[model samples]
Target: MAEQADHADRADRAGHADRAGHADHPAYPVGLRLHGRRVVVVGGGQVAQRRLPQLIATGAVITLISPSATPSVEAMADAGEIRWEHRRYQDGDLADTWYALIASSDTTANDAASAEAERTRTWCVRADDAEAATAWTPATGRSENVTVAVLTTTSQGRDPRHSAAIRDAIVEGLRDGTLAAPHHRTRAPGVALVGGGPGDPDLITVRGRRLLAEADVVIADRLGPRDLLDELPPHVEVIDAAKIPYGRFMAQEAINQALIEHAKAGKSVVRLKGGDPFVFGRGMEEAQALAAEGIPCTVVPGISSTISVPGAAGIPVTHRGVAHEFTVVSGHVAPEDPRSLVDWEAVARMRGTLVLLMAVDKIGAIAAALIAHGKDPATPVALVQEGTTAAQRRVDATLADVGERAVAEDVRPPAVIVIGDVVAVGPHSAPTTGQDRPGDQQ
Candidate 1:
């Protein structure tokens, strides 16, 4: 008992000395070269959860020593990204570890791991006590290829929250282009399918914009943000995707071939489409085609117009106490047409928002069919022309008068026809023209 007491006394003193030494010597800011090195993490709680991802990204062979860990940490272990020991930290857990993170809430266990790390000549980080840690983790932000790390040691001592705020601000600036990235294009050679989001240039995602800037060849859709094309450099080859054979399958194949051929010719190609590629845009076909040729493809998803267009015009597809469901259907063909597969009778029975895309031409026939199928003639409708763009216009009508109203108002194609009570809830209330004018010819 006396010998064990003396050893415990020695361990306590050693821990106190280690803490004092850490406090006396401020941490020198440096990024670790942890690539392909063994890193031992002695804890599986919240603190370890935050640190594990950074270590994993560095290509570190992580060995997590803990009886139990957070669900995310457990998931990482399950995914084979990190090796979890699933046991308490033993004396020599850090034997082959090049770096150690002692994040256990149990101070004694943290001390033991830190001591083991120190003895093995490994850098150790302590979450419970930064003063006891030989190394400190910096708040980090990455923008494109640049990683910005902010360490608050003495100058901004013990204020990780402030450091993180600064890091976030830097990241925000990077995303918004307030901080300039090198104009020199640096994306890897491959085909990137970017969703341009409706017809607005600003709605394009940050990654999409960055990739667009790097594109050597851009295959642009007709409905894609046209303003973005004007911004591209003179040297960039821009192909009008709509002009590529009008047959759906043929056009898709041609677009895929263009992407593959461009990439094969050592050009970075971007297939920019309006709305999400998978949402009626047939983006996966392009991706699958690229995959067959072993050509890498990157997809940047965009906001779909089915939701965005209505929402922009102050029409929520799903509203509380009004609509719980919304159905978006292509209106290219008439319900009476043999090629049309839509169940007009069933659609008429549904008491939900009906968003009709590409249906302006056959909308009168569609409305007539809906009413014939037991739909109310007074169901409100809002025809949004070129929604979410400069050419945006809304014409109010009802199922009974929408067809005639459309003819009277000279409503054109490329308009979204919103039907249901949700259309009544639209912010813009343009009174429908009751009288036919001389030049109001459809």
Candidate 2:
């Protein structure tokens, strides 16, 4: 009997070697049009739960055969997404089936069903044994109009994690404009006001990145994720709306005219700015300008730095019991500036948190006004400079001495100032020199 068992083990190894040696007969990749066609899944366990959603999406006529199933699979049956036979697999289960997946826990049932699929010349996948299966599933992903599928034809080289990693890489490249397929897509002529998010290229919205990938012309600001510009195709034109070659920034009127002219000339235009286009970004001005010229405009919201910046430095604008409300105010102009629209006195009187953007230069006067109006001079303040970028740092101070700290610490513009007790609630509330903080990656 031991000799017979040794012989069987040798035969099994020989079978595996035979399959591995037939490299020329590798699986030929083809996408099945399973819509309205019969498909059978012989298991309702974890495998079925994971693979059913993609099958149902194909609009195929699916029938699942199993005595029991996971709750999620049962839910799919209850929702009429699939027909569940609540019985053990029978010999004729694969009859008239276009494709079959044999994944039942019972080895005997799986073998029978796989044999039926083979006898009927139907393509089948055996989860228990890939070598015995006639077909294999590829790691798939969709980016816009593109569908990516990665497969390893050789059984010896098969690795699901490797295939999934390749799929993710390709999809991410397609979404981020690194892999531009301009020849395959028809470009539409219009203006898209896309907020590029704080300073990180990855922070940009997927929609914003997709629009950028399809753009014929991009009018970019200096503040946002400028690194993305280096990824644009050579045929695409990038206009520096923030600065010109002559040491002067382009005027708002000129920028508006640029958008209108490019769009009218039958080019896809993207006005990529930092932060949300609607939050003090003059996005409405651009939208109104486009409307006046009858140009179509699409606004894509972005992650605003007003909240994200402080959060990156471990500050929450609103903490339970610390502050119930937070107000975002632009500090481009000093509190005493004639053109300033913010009522500093009224703002100081509010008991909630105060978040000031573009306020590094004017924080001193602003702090003094807040103190005089009724805010506590000793209220904790945090200045996050170049927030969410490689150069990000935090400066801790109070309303009474933030002005001096700003100058002494060489704090620059593009800093977010946070005031109120919420500043003291964060873990990074401890005092630190103006240097790169932890987790301040690009």
Candidate 3:
């Protein structure tokens, strides 16, 4: 009898603490089916701009009442996604409205519109005052087909940042298969051309990582974030599709044939390449080849080393008052080679930054051509090798001696060559030995 009495007392104390933690009654959460219903948004500022897309997605007949709106809101109105009254809120705007959002800059107008919503017995959300709002918008995110919504309130009040953090955690977990729910599995058979970003596994995009997590087969390149393959499930077939330059390598035609065969066999295929597939990565060629075979292809863009590698080495491709234009070109062929399509003379005529990829082997001839075509012989140059990876390093030199410097440092392929005054513009312009770490110099 005494133990039962103690349990009852403890339960009463827990209930009391729960009630004391909230300043107002706990809000009951519900998903409103708002399709074909009248929804009015008062104001057209950042708050309204942020909320409009979700409201628009509900298929509600939305009417936006404001004298002025941000450019994005104006675009929505122009696109006919919503009807814009081009006027301020009046008393009767909430009549027959099923739901309303009050986010105008004018507090008096917000108060008036919210009061009208109250009188009409319609639910309304107030961006200015959550205490007075009849409805609260939850922090929402979508992962795969699952929608995660979180609404959290502290002893003080609504903690939106906390709610957002929770939402992000849930969404990331679901996306990467960390949550491991049955409904979140991906079984679709198609090809996804994913850009693995510039050598850093962490730099790969969320979409790319999610696709990798779902892939039954991953055809990987030698240059991209190869570490990502180690994280795949044991059942996933990781094909070594490395295209080594001037060595044992798989031909492009063979790679295309392999992708077709695997996809035709009903396995989900991901052609993971280094950097963006479209940016000189021969991604469009594979895309075209897949199209010929009637295979569905999804291209996910990655961060290209053309810009990111230089950035990783503390060099902005373009700086204010320094360089207005930065040109990126492939330097696999010497400038004098008939097979080369790049107009090296025109490139040298421009007074801007020049970024070269696959040019380590031909740097001597390329630099001589640039100097001969009016480019300054003493123009600064920095080569970032294995950029964004642990082995990344920077080799600095001038255009006149970059060829000699490349030989002295023994710079190899897979290095990005940045040429121009912009290399000398940053705090990291100091020369370094080849052993300098990327984080230390970049």
Q: Candidate 1's residue-wise lDDT over 1-442, tens digit each?
A: 9999899889868867866655455568888888999999988999889888988999999999899999999999999999999788889778888889898877888888877876666888888877666778899988777889988765325799999999998876676444546656654679999999988888988878878876899999988899888877789999888732234333667888899999999888999998888877889989999999999999999988898988888888866556767998889889999999899999999998999988887899999999999999999999988889999998999999998988899987668889998887644655444344645532
- Candidate 3 segments exceeding 4 Å error: 1-28, 33-36, 44-46, 57-59, 66-88, 104-112, 152-158, 181-186, 427-442
- Whole-model lDDT for model 1 versus the true structure? 0.84
The Cα local distance difference test for each model comes to 0.84, 0.88, 0.89
Backbone clash pairs for candidate 1 read none
How big is the RMSD of model 3?
9.3
How many residue pairs of model 1 clash at the backbone? Answer: 0
Lowest-sum lDDT 10-residue window in model 1 = 243-252
Candidate rank order under TM-score = 3, 2, 1
lDDT at position 68, candidate 2: 96
**Considering every candidate listed, which one attains the maximal lDDT?**
3
Query: What is the per-residue lDDT of model 3 for residues 1-442, given as tens digits with 9 covering 90 to 100?
Result: 9999898788768745754554656678889899999999999999989999999998999999999999999999999999999999999999899999999999999999988886677999999987677788999999867789998653256789989999999999777655556535556677999999999998988888888888889999999799888888899999888877798888899999999999999899999999999988999999999999999999999999999999999999986556778999999999999999999989999888999999998999999999999999999999999999999999999999999999999898799999998899777555434443455433
**Where in model 1 is the C-alpha error above 4 Å?**
1-122, 126-132, 142-148, 152-189, 240-261, 282-296, 319-324, 390-396, 407-413, 421-442
| Candidate number of the best TM-score | 3
Selected candidate, larger lDDT, 2 vs 3:
3
Error of 1 at 250 (Å): 13
Steric clash pairs (candidate 3):
313-442
Per-residue lDDT for 59-142 in model 2, tens only?
Answer: 999999999999999999999999999999998888889999888899999888877886787899999988778789889999
